[model samples]
Target: MKSYSAVVALAGLVSSVAAHGFISSPTPRQPGQGLKAACGDQVYNQQSSDHFGNVQGALQNLQGSQPDCRMWHCKGVPFSDAGEVFDYTPGQVIPMKVEIRAPHDGVANVSIVKVSSDTVIGQPLISWDQYALTSSPLSQHPDWTSFDIKMPDVSSECAKAGDCVIQWYWDAPKISQTYESCIDFKMGGGSGGSAPSPSASAAPASSAAPKPSSAAPATSATPTATVPAATPTPSKVEEVATPTASSGAGEGSTLPKSFTIDSFITWLRANAGSDTATKVSRAVAERAHPRAFRV
Candidate 1:
């Protein structure tokens, strides 16, 4: 009887880990041949592995162990150079999947960054709130949901740079937690046929980082080789309540990364030039997330 009870307990534990929320579409966490695999470097899914971290806070990123959106450090997964690289076109429409094995209230953001070095992280090329602007993955999708994402164009230089990161951040506002993932890849295909949508583009590929100011131009010019100015701060959106995010947010964390329905709508409208952001104005943000409002 004792042996049977122990076996049953262990089985239950394994089931819970496998049943946690995970990104199933791109398969970055479990990428096979040809695509770089970095998920195994840290606590791929912490709350489960031995069930060590906070379970209810399965999405948390700023606390013990999983600091800065991830535990892999700023230079990215160590020895990543030995890993594989996924090949993609400059402007391809990519799809994403987030299996909410454990559904919770949150928002998702995806962005592109040029990995200038293994030691230094790069800036954003595109940033937007996937959940708030188009549809609420929280309320819209079933347990395991899949959605199509429009890819953005890269500068000829950026496309040829050979390495970049497609970063994803998930914020659980109701729970004050966040989850993160990245797909490393090499760009393929020709350039310049279609520019990135205004709603999708964020930081300039080659320019210095945008200064964190209330008055930065909505449409800034392309930059040269000089180091960028100060990091751009959250626009007026910082006034809203927000949870502390992973230090890993860097320059690519979008305005909706820290949302309170209001900030989300403001960001969505500015970039998308539509009323889509406002559509989800009732969104409740953190004490529950890997959250932010660019603040």
Candidate 2:
């Protein structure tokens, strides 16, 4: 009787952990051979088995583990494993979809993230302050499950295929679980192509367009490469400052002027009080020391 009860409880726990979310359309990055090499077989297998698992879970598995995994960035999936790179233009509107097997009320956003620095380029393309709320059924809130994000003009930095990614970030802060999905893309000349409409169950994709918000442009005459300017907490749909020398890091403590992953990690460590920064910093510091980084 005791053994049977234990087995049932374990099954329930596994089922609960497995019920999560991930990007379904625009085909987010997947765990593959490169991931197995960089992250090691264990971490890669975990994600390969369950792509919807949160960052914290993956980090937990990374105790004194692979430094090259970069688990906090796109769940550490490498671009070499990325099968297709979508060609996009500045104004292109791309259809997107997310599959939430279980809802956990929190916030979500989509942004252009520079792979090199793990920094968001400009503001988020779309955001939801109240996302994946369990009070309402997924059927009633189609916007949370399906939407569209406009590609902002990132031609200067994202002209190359591997330089940037369209990243979908969802953080259920209450649960301390962060989920990310990245789409590999680059800017291409010519008119941006039209996207197919989302499924009938989806809310009108037009409704997902975020309100305009202020953010600093990447400056040319690179000032002291500090952290970045302030960005809103993950709970709100707000602007994300560009990570550049002119943008400044966080408050207090100055490292070298050149902005790199090390600098960003330094910033993350410095800004450890912040909700987003702190969580990510802890995972990064614990799992691996700074290694050659890519998104």
Tens digits of per-residue lDDT, candidate 2, 1-295, equal: 4222342344234323633888888777899998888888777888888888876677645544587887767888988889678888877778888899788876676778889888777667766666687777777677877777778888889888889998887766555567788989888666655445666665443544332224322232111123253332333222244457564565455433544444554564564434434434443332321111100
Which window of 10 residues has the lowest lDDT sum in candidate 2? Answer: 286-295
lDDT at residue 22 of model 2 (Cα atoms): 87
Instruction: Report the lDDT of model 1 for residue 145.
Output: 47
lDDT of 1 by residue, 129-243 (tens): 3232123433433212444444555544345433556655544433333455555555656432221233222222232222221222233221112223334232333344563
> How does model 1 fare in lDDT?
0.37
For each candidate in turn, give its C-alpha RMSD to the true structure in angstroms.
17.3, 13.7
TM-score of each: 0.41, 0.65
Estimate every model's Cα lDDT from 0 to 1. 0.37, 0.64
At residue 245, candidate 2 shows an lDDT of 55
Q: Pick the candidate with the highest TM-score.
A: 2
lDDT of 1 at 169: 51
Clashes of each: 15, 4
